[model samples]
Target: MLYIIGLGLCDETDITVKGLEAIKSCERVYLEAYTSILMVPKEQLEKFYGKELIIADREMVESQSDEILLNANSLNIAFLVVGDPFGATTHTDLVIRARELNIPVTVIHNASIINAIGACGLQLYNFGQTISIPFFTDTWKPDSFYDRIKENKDLGLHTLCLLGKKIYEPPRYMAINKAIQQLFEIEETRNQKVYTTESLAIGIARLGSSTDQKIKVGTLNQLLSQDFGPPLHSLVIVGSRVHILEIDFMRFFAVDKQLYNEIVKKDYGI
Candidate 1:
């Protein structure tokens, strides 16, 4: 049997009871290290899990999965994912390959940033599409994400912009400030007025961890200057459909209370 388990967001202790049991039963356990990461170190997770974990980078998972899946038909193997197993399409491809090899698979579900972003007080149903903002290069800047944000704005729906990271060559993660700067540059080039300095945005860092996680609500201009410590950040572009209850909840995390209110009322008309 091949088990794909979710580690959930944050530390090693976040794994579900079933996931832990599966880990204990498996002969070999591999941790997928590229898509997302946990707050604790690999040693900590291994100590808690009581199993030696093999680190699986992008190349190993994508190119050399056969080795990882070897003997799965005769023995139990565990593939651990940082968030929900299905959060990334790469895991789905793994399942397909496993099935083709006649290996039985089981996936253990857990909380991901997709649902956890509700901590910002935005309604889940009000969100349009989730887009990823990749690092822009001098010769290869991508503006496709801008269109998704514009579509969300046109529908009065919120947009969740997940910051992208390269596949662990240098382990660089996009910060909230950098993401905002990239968005502003995109707007400057396109001039669609999809978003602006006065547009409301929420910058979140270290999500799912109770201690280090930071959630800040303010305009792009307000949040661009604020410092969000550490990596693994996400940004949310507020829409016009924000509810009164949401406004009340978000005000607690605003950079400036009065300014947040003014943008919501004047700009969002909510």
Candidate 2:
């Protein structure tokens, strides 16, 4: 059997009990390192699970997957992903390949930012569409996600922006400031108030991790100067103001205390 296990969002301990059992039973374990990352290292996971893990970066996973799947039909091979197994489209393809080979595969589910994003108090049901913001190159700045954010803002729905990530480097993070600047540039070109520097937004970092993980609420312009720690981050553009519960939840972070009142004043139509 081939098992695709979700390591959840944080560290080694985040794995579900069932997933842990599956990991132990497997003969070989492969961890895909490209799509997303965990706060803990591969060694920590190995120590906890007592399983020999092979790190599969982008090149390995995409170019040399045969090595991981070679004996899957005869041996129990396990492929691990940081979040839920289905979080990335690549894993879906792996499943497709397994089926084509007549290998019985099982997907072990766990927590992922896709669903954990509700920690910000934004109604998940109210989100219109999710978009990603990639790094803007000097000659290739793209605002393709701008229209999607506009549509969501027009409907008073929320837009979740999963920030771009570049691991294996020293700096290794797309800062929140850069994301805000890109949004401002898009707004300037479109000459639209769909979203502005003062527009309410949230920045999240190391979401499921225990240390230094937080959700901060502020305007894009206000968030421009703030520092959010770590590489894996996500931003949210809010469309509508609803219950007081959201405001309360956001207050845990300084940005919310400093900005949400103004956002509520404007977005709530008070």
Candidate 3:
């Protein structure tokens, strides 16, 4: 049997009750370190789980999965993900391969950033297509996400931006500043009004951690200069008018109140 377990968003304690049980029972436990990560260190998780787990990097998972799955025929092997197991597609492929090998599989789920961004004071149901902002390289800047953000804005729906996380090495998180810059650069070239520096946005960081934070009613200009702190962050761009209660709730962590209020009225449709 192969178990795909979700470690939730913050720390080791965030693991679901069922997932923890499987981790303790599994013969070999592996942590998928690439896609996303908890706020705590791997050492903390080992102490909590009471198991000697192997760290699986992208190279190993993509090239040496058979090595991890080799002895699972009679043993219970578990692959732990930082968020809900299916939040990333790489995890989905692992399950498919396990099925081909006739291994019975079970998924233990938990909170994922996909639905966790509601803390930004926006209604979850008002969200449209979610897009990822990738790290721009010198020669390969891509802004294809602009079209989707525009499409969502046109419909009066919010846009959730899942900033890219690279797991090939130790996980490297893309900051919101870089994301905004890349988006505006593309908008600049395309002559598009889809997104601009003055566009209203929200930045949330460390979603499930004790010190988790949210900054509401910021513009691309204000948001780009602000640091949300830590990795594993996400940003949201509100499409149009929403319940004023949402804005009031998010104001508790407002970084730049005067500017935020201005943008919220002009862009967020107050």
Candidate 4:
């Protein structure tokens, strides 16, 4: 049997009891290391789960997945992901491959940023299509995400921008400030007015961590100046459909409550 388990959003302890049991029962455990990351190291998880984990990078998962599924018909193999197994499309491909090989598969689900984002007080039901903002290069800036964000804003639905990260590269995670700068650059180039420097945005860093998690509510210009420590950051663009309760709740994290209220009133009309 092949088991694909979610490690939740934070550290080793965040794994579900069922996931832990599956890991223990498996003969070989592989940790998917590229899509997202945990707060703790692999050593910590090994100490807690009492099993040495084999690190699987992008190349191994995408190009050598057959090796992972090899002997699964006879031996139990566990493939672990940092968030919910289905959060990334790559894992879906893995499941498809396993099925093609006639390998029985079991998936254990857990909390991911897709749902845990509600912790910032935005209504989950109000979210539209989620988009990822990739790190821009001198000759390779992509503005496709801007169109999706505009489409969501047109419907008065919230936009959750999952910042991109290349684990193999230096500075693996995209910082909130860098994401804002990229958004600003796009806005300047397109001039669609989908969002502005004065628009309300929430910067979240190290989510699901008990102690290091940080959330800041402010404008794009405001957020660009503030520091969101470390990696694994996400940003949310407030839409016109924000509820009164959400405004009240977000006030707790606002950088400047009065400014936030004024912008919401001017842009979101809330």
TM-score list, all predictions: 0.96, 0.92, 0.92, 0.96
- lDDT against true structure, model 4: 0.90
Off by over 4 Å in 1: 168-170
Worst window of 10 by summed lDDT in candidate 4:
164-173
Error of 2 at 5 (Å): 0.6
Give the alpha carbon lDDT tens digit for every residue of 105-173 in model 4.
999998899999999999999999999898899999999999999999999999999998564553368
Q: For each candidate, what is the lDDT? A: 0.90, 0.81, 0.81, 0.90
Please list the residue runs of candidate 2 whose C-alpha ends up more than 4 Å from where it truly belongs after superposition: 166-172, 254-259
| Candidate 2 similarity to native, TM-score | 0.92
* lDDT at 87, model 3: 72
Best by TM-score: 1
Clashes (candidate 2):
0
Question: Weakest 10 consecutive residues, lDDT, candidate 1?
Answer: 164-173
lDDT of 4 at 148: 99
How many collisions per candidate?
0, 0, 0, 0
Off by over 4 Å in 4: 167-171
lDDT of 3: 0.81
Q: In model 3, how large is the Cα lDDT of residue 112?
A: 85
Model 1, 1-270: lDDT tens digits are: 999999988999889999999999999999998877888899999999999999998889888889999999999999999878876445866888899999999999988888889998999999999998989999988999999999999999999998876665645789999999999999999999999998999999988898899999998998899999987899999988878899999999999998887877787576
Report the C-alpha lDDT of model 2 over 1-270, residue by residue, as the tens digit. 899999999989999999999999999999887777788788999999999899887676656767778889999999999889876444766777778888899989988878898988877888888887878888987788998998888888889887765443322557777888888887888887788777788888888777778677888877888888766788998777456776667667647564567667777763
